[model samples]
Target: MSRHLRLALVQAPAESFEQFADGLRLRMKSPNRAELVVYPELHLCSRGAEAMTLEEYYDTYAEPLDGPRGAALGALARELGVWLIPGTVLERAEDGKVHNTAVVYGPDGELVAHYRKIFTWRPYEPLCVGREFVVFDLPGTARIGLSVCYDAWYPEVTRHLAWMGAELVVNLVQTSTSGRAQEIPVNTANAIVNQIWVASVNGASPTAQGRSLLVDPEGHVQVAAVGTEDTTLLAVVDLDRVAAARKHGTGGDSWPWDHFAPDDTPLELPLYGGRIDPVTWRPAVSPWTPEALRPAVPAPVPTAPCPAAGAAGEETAR
Candidate 1:
């Protein structure tokens, strides 16, 4: 199935949820026969949480997965006969917990897949992070993985998704000036590792410069937007390229396999012994290091209760 699908990426100013949606609707008047339309992270809410208080923002802007914002996007997708990846939204789940969620709408105005942000930004730890990585099969030989803003920084997450047979990884990023450089490496590394396409949608303002891009499976920048102005990016991607890249060794002369392997033992060292600051006696550098660079190992997985407790009551009853 060697067919091409057109994907549109919107890079607009960080406006209020309602205004942003209205602007998008106006801009997307008649898409150029595109198969999908993608948006940037927190497309509804501004980043930094500077404009509004948490309580006020949540009450005023938060939507359920099937709420008005979602419904409208879904309807748009159906109207256009396309897939719509409406970045991540601050939404209230049935559990009453707030999550940063990405919802996919199919051409029929039905909810295709709903994925929440797995890696919550440091400032918003109070919000519950999503535990699962979602990859869904599309109608016409397309497989996609969805990610939120900060999630792109974690290469392991993208690597695993690539391993799970994702042909494309879509990221909705809220790129601040400080962390903009990191985005390229993160997305490109995934393409290099998994040999899949990456589509990134970024915000356009100086505070949030849009560096929207589409990278090939071989980590080549197929198309990228300028950071100067607000714009929408449109591109046609061939799924066959992803499959070919996976087989052709990413067109690289060399690959660093030694880097991805698990270490034999945890690296730890004493803090101090003979240091320059003798009175304080604190080591300038400690040998202690994490199993991986992204984060320390998570706590051990919990085990289920043993079956003996269930049988113990049966014997007494008999």
Candidate 2:
């Protein structure tokens, strides 16, 4: 099977729900239409939240997974015959807790997967954190994983996803322009170290610079949006690069999977255990069981031989 996937990244301001839908419609109509369309984090609620209080934003924008916004996104995916990741929505789950949720719709417009933001950006954002990492199969294509905004800062998030057999990892971001220089490099490094494709989409607001980008397994930036402009970046990602990268290490050394232990038994470090006062340093109980730590199935091995050095290059469609 061909391991190529054409993807479209939508980088635009979420001024209103209507504007978001319109922008998405326009992008989908492009001559370089893609099999997958991705949007920025908090794409539907961020702009509106700027004008209202936190409580008001929650009351106004937070809805269930089956609400109007999710329905509209599903309809759009069905209409375009594209797999869609419509960014992270502010969801009020049945548990009555509000979460920053990312939803995936299959080409047939069915909800296939959803992931809540595990590491919420702190200080002001009020959202319930997610416990588990999500990686799902994309039928005949490749397994994909999702992270949102600050989650990319934690290497464990991407590493766990890769360990779980994700060839491509998507990150939806909503952050200030000042942080772009820092954010891009870190995410690019995540791609290189994890040996997976990293597609990051950022919201286009005055506060947020829309430098959406795609980084290949080799850590090369395939495509990036210009400045804070509203634009769509389209690229053809070769999933085969992932296996090649894992087999051949970055910097001329063989990739060192033999020494790495992802499932090492838990051990308490003395510095953490002995330094901090037990009363003040209470750790939250983890929700993941031993079964959850293991991959549902082993990652599919690539049958093809590695490409010649420097043969893998960015395939961008403006």
Clashing pairs in 1: none
lDDT of 1: 0.71
TM-scores vs. true structure, each candidate? 0.74, 0.80
Model 2 over residues 1-318: C-alpha lDDT tens digits? 336889988887776767766766777777658898888888777775768987898899899989887888788789889898888888999988999999999888788999999999886677999999998777766788999989999987998788687888999998874878788998999998776899999977664788889999888999998688877889998876776555456555756442323333334567546332222221111122122222232233435566755565433322
CA deviation > 4 Å runs, candidate 1: 15-33, 47-49, 252-318
> How much is the lDDT of residue 31 in candidate 2?
66
TM-score quality measure for candidate 2:
0.80
Question: Ten consecutive residues with minimal summed lDDT in candidate 1?
Answer: 281-290
For model 2, the run of ten residues with the poorest summed lDDT: 280-289
Best by TM-score: 2
In order, the Cα lDDT scores of the candidates are 0.71, 0.78
